[model samples]
Every structure is written in structure tokens, then in C-alpha cells.
Target: MRFIIQRDHLVQSVQDVMKAVTSRTTIPILTGIKMVVSDEGVTLTGSDSDVSIESFIPKEEDDKEIVDIKQTGAIVLQAKFFSEMVKKLPSDTVEIEVQNHLQTVIRSGNSEFNLIGLDADEYPHLPQVEEENIFKIPTDLLKAMIRQTSFAVSTSETRPILTGVNWKIENNELNCIATDSHRLALRKAKVEIDSAAHYNVVIPGKSLNELSKILADNNELIDIVITENQILFKAKHLLFFSRLLEGNYPDTSRLIPTESKTDVVLQTKEFLQAIDRASLLAREGRNNVVKLSTLEDKIVEISSNTPEVGKVVEEIKALSVEGEELKISFSAKYMMDALKALEGTEIKVSFTGAMRPFIIQPINDDSILQLILPVRTY
Candidate 1:
């Protein structure tokens, strides 16, 4: 196998595929990257059994050559060393040639290195997912959706399903929900797809986060295909595959409160800043709890006190505080995370009671919703 490729493109492609490679895999060959040189282009693949990524660099695009293929063949090289070597190669182009006995030589700008390559045939084949049930979403919206909800996934493995974000698409509406049991984030968006499209899947939060890091923030649509056990995301010159979680995601709809006992409208920024300041003292507390109480004339007080540390108290004026007066204690970190995820100037915080879960949502927009269970401080 021999190919001369542009250095910049090679570096970028290597970085993207490296996200899927891991050193702790049971299959030894999975530690290396599989490279296939063909007549059409060069394909690089990396996988850790759970997640796999593939990048294809065409021989030429728009009459400009990207890869000059000398011989059609395949090789597997150690991912860690090969990636670092390609990044630091001192040349505009790098030439890679596989010699007898699986010996691979890399050369660029008077720098030459030989690496013992593994046979590409030893690499496990990626799952073959049919593209019949396909859905499309814009890259930027997908990234935003991941950012807004992935954080809420449970880190604990006791209930494995909660470690992933539940994705449900039906009637052209996409709804994503993630929760660690203490807090929940829900994001909704309209997808342009065939009316008959329907799917319910659980995608690992870690995989989504890694995918988000590699996706370009653009209006380009990403084609998604779902099967019985795997989900494939196809982008320009890239293909990402992730194994679906095995269990059915818990029903989260019943968890959201339908009615509010008290509702307060406040500027999102001011509330976030007040919570941030109050958390300084709360951080020293075991639960990191901050208290919020409604006062007369639409004033809300934010306070936190730790015995070892001084207390913090601040008051912020709300646009309107209606219904019964409320006092709720919750983790400051949870509140701040929810506030940052919400998109808008003004937000409505609804409380069912001092002991029940409360919701924070952007005023007049139902696309995003956040729920935090109040911490018991009694």
C-alpha cells in the first residue's frame, strides 16, 4: 500500500478518528487504525467496540488532488504513534508505503520512520446498519441538543440506561431527554423528515459528547440511520457508529410536573449570577444547597450558609411572582447548569411546592425545559 496525502488533511482526519480509539480494548487490533487505499479514496477507521469512526479522503475534489494513490492496498498502524508522527511531519505532503513483512515506512521532508504494521484483515468489521430508516438533522442543532442535555446523564452505572440520553423522534418532532435522577434536561426540536419517521433509542452520553467535538458547527445536514442495535451518523466524508444501549429507557414524561403552585418570571442572567455568588458559601456545605424564597412585591432572596464559612444573601427583583409564596432549597450547581442551558433573556421558574421538583424554562419558548429536585434541608 502506498499513498501520498496532503499533511493538513491527514492531520485533521487522524485527530477525528482518534476519538474512537482506546488502549484498554480486549481486541488487540482495535488499538490500531485501519487504513484502506482504494481507487476512489483512502479510508481510515478507528473503533473501541462501542464507538467507531471512519473518515474518507477522496483522491481528488473539484479537480484538485487530495490523495495521490500509488498502489491499492490496506494496512493497520498503531494509532498513538502514527497520529503523533503525522501531526509533526515537516512537509506539505507525507508519503506512506507498506513494504514486505508488514513493515510500513513514513517519509516527509527528509524525516523517515519505519513502523511495524498489523494486517488490516485482523481488524473487526464494523456493524453493517441498513439505511432504510433514516433521519436527518442539522449539525449545529445536533451539537446544541447534545450540549443542553448530555450533562444530565447519570455517571453511575447502577442503572445503565440513565447514562445515555433518550432520543425519541415521531411525527417529525425530535425530543431528547437526559437525567441523573436528581436533575433532568429536556430539549425539543423540529426535524425535517418524512412524516412516517419514528424511532426510540438510547445513545450513550459519552459517545454523543465525543461526536459533538468532531462535528463542524454548520447548517449541513447529518444523515442518521438506526437499526436494532447500532446507530450510524453520516456526514460529509465522515461516518460515526455507536452501539445502542441495551435496555429500554425509563418513561420520563410522568416525571415532569403539569401544574405549578407558584411561578416567578426573572431575568435569566441575574438569577444565574445571584446563584453563583450564593454558591460560594454553599460549596462548603455537604449538599452545596442554596435557598430561594419569594418575598413581597416580586422580590426573591437567594441565600446560603455554611457553619465553617460565612453566609451569603442576595435579593433579585423578579418580573412577577404569582400564586403562593415559595421557598425552595436546591443544589446550586444544578440550578446554574439549567440556567445556562436555557436560551432567552427572561425565564419562568415554576414550583409545585417547597418539596417537589421545580422547572426552569425560557419564557414563551417551549423548546427547552429543565427540572431540578429540591434538596431536603430540613
Candidate 2:
């Protein structure tokens, strides 16, 4: 295999694929990057069994030659060394050639390095998801959904299913929900689909986070395909595949309370800042719990106390406080996370009781909702 390619393009492709490459992979070949040069373009692939990413660089784009291929072939090179070498290459162009016995030479402006290559055939194949159950969503919206929900996935693998975000699609509306048994985040978006496909899948939170970082922020629609065990995200010049977790995600619909005992509307920023300040001392406590007590005339007192640290109390006037007055305690970090995920100036927090899980959502926008379980401080 031999190719002379634009260095920047190669570097970007390498970085994108490297998100899937890991030194900890059990398969020896999975640690290296597989590169294939064809008549159309050069393709780079990386995988760790759980996630696989492939990036393509066209030979010529818009009448400009981006890669000049001398011989169409394939090779796999050590991803760690190859990625670092490509970035530090002195020239704008890089030439790669392979000789007998899988010996590879990489050359740039005054520097040349020899690397041992592996046969590309040994690399595992990424799943070929059928296009039958495909949907399209705007890239920017997809990223927002990921950011809003992925953070709530359980970090503990005790209940392995909760470590992923549950995606349920019906009637062209996609609902994403994640929870760690303490806090839950839900985001809904409408997508275009090819069929009346009803898909309930659990996607690993790590995979979605990685995909969010790699995808460009754009309004263009990206194709998504879901099968029984794998999901594919197809973007321009990129293919991302993630294996679905092999278990039924717990039914979380019943977890959201239907009735409210106390409902308070407050400025999102003010509430968030109060929690941030109150958390300063709450962090020293065992549970990092901050207390919220409803006061007269649409005001709420935010306070926290730690015997060793100190106590903090602040009053924030809400837009309106309805229903019954109540006091509740919850994790300060969880409230801050929910507030950051919302996009609005005002928010409505509905509390069923002092001990029940409360719901926080942006006022007038029902597409996103966050729920936090209260902590007990008796």
C-alpha cells in the first residue's frame, strides 16, 4: 500500500478514529489503526469491540487532489505511534508505503520513519446495520440530547442496564432517558424515520459521549440505524458503530410522579447560584445535601449545615409558589447538573412531598425534564 496524503486531513481522521482505539483492548490488532487505500479514497478504522469508528478521506475533492494513491492496498499500523507521528510531521503532505513482509515507511519533509504493519484482514469487521430501521436527526439537536441525558446515566455497573441511556422511539418522536437511581434526565426530539419503527435500545453512555465530541456542530441531518444488537451513526465521511447493551432497560415511566404537592417557579440562574453557594459548605457534609424550604410571599430559603464546616442560608424570591409549602433536601451537584442541562431563564420545580423525588423542568418547554431524589437529613 502506498499513498501521499494531505497531512492535516490524515491527522484529523486519525484523531477521530482513535477515540475507539484503546491500549487495553484484548485483541492485539485492535490496538492498531487499519488503513485502506482504494480508488475512491482512503479509509481509517479503529475499534475496541464495544465501539468502532471509521473515517474516510476522499482522493480528490472539489477538483483538488487530497490524496494521491500509488497502489491501492491496505495495512494496519500501531495507532499510538502513528497518530503521534502524523501530528508532528514537518510537511503539509505525508507519504506512506509498504514493502515486503508488511514493512511500512512513513516520510514527510525531512523526516522518515519505518513501522511494522499488520495484515488488515485480521481486524474484526464492524457490524453492517441494515437501513431498514433508519432515522434522521439534526446533528446539533442530537448532540444536545446526548449532553442533556448522558450525564444522568449511572456510573455504577451494579445494575449494568442503568449505565446506559435508554432510547425509545415511537411515532417519529425519540425519547432519551438516563438515571442513576438518584437523578434522572429525559429529553425528547422529533426525527424523520423510514418506517413506523418502535425501537427501545440501551446505548452505552460512554459511546454517546465519545460520539458527541467527535461530531461537528451542524444542522445537517445525520442518519441513524438501529438493529437488534447494534446501532450505527452515519455522518459525512464518518461511520460510528456501537454495540447495544444486552439487557432490558428498566421501565422508568412509572418513576416520574404524577401529582405535585408544592410547585415553585424561580429564575433558573438565581436558583442555580444559590445552590452553588450553599453547596460550598454542603460539600463538607457527608451527603453534599442542600435544603430548600418554602417561605411566605413566594420566597424559598436555601440552606446547608455541616457541624465541622459551617451553615449557609439565602432567600430567593420565586416568580410564584403554589400548592403547599414544603422543605426538601437533595444533592447539590444533582441540582446544578439539572439546571445546566436546561435552556431557559425560568424553571418550575414540582415537589410531591418533602421526601418524594421532585421534578425540575424549564418553564413552557416540556421537551426536557429532570428529576432528583431527595436526601434525608434527620
TM-score of 2: 0.98
After superposition, candidate 1 runs with Cα above 4 Å error? none
Error of 2 at 278 (Å): 0.6
lDDT tens digits, residue span 1-378, model 1: 899999998999999999999999999998899999999989999999999999999999899999999998999999999999999999999999999959999999999999999999888999999888778899999999999999999999999999999999999999999999999999999987788978899999999999999999898999999898899999999999999998989999998999999999999999999999999988877888999999998999999999887999999999999999888899999999999988899999999999999899999988999999998888
Q: Against the hidden true structure, what lDDT does model 1 obtain?
A: 0.94
* TM-score between model 1 and native: 0.98
Candidate 1 pairs with clashing backbones: none
lDDT (0 to 1) per candidate = 0.94, 0.95
What lDDT does model 2 reach? 0.95
List the candidates' TM-scores in order: 0.98, 0.98
Error of 1 at 247 (Å): 1.1
Per-residue lDDT tens digits for candidate 2, residues 22-67, read 9997899999999999999899999999999999999998899999
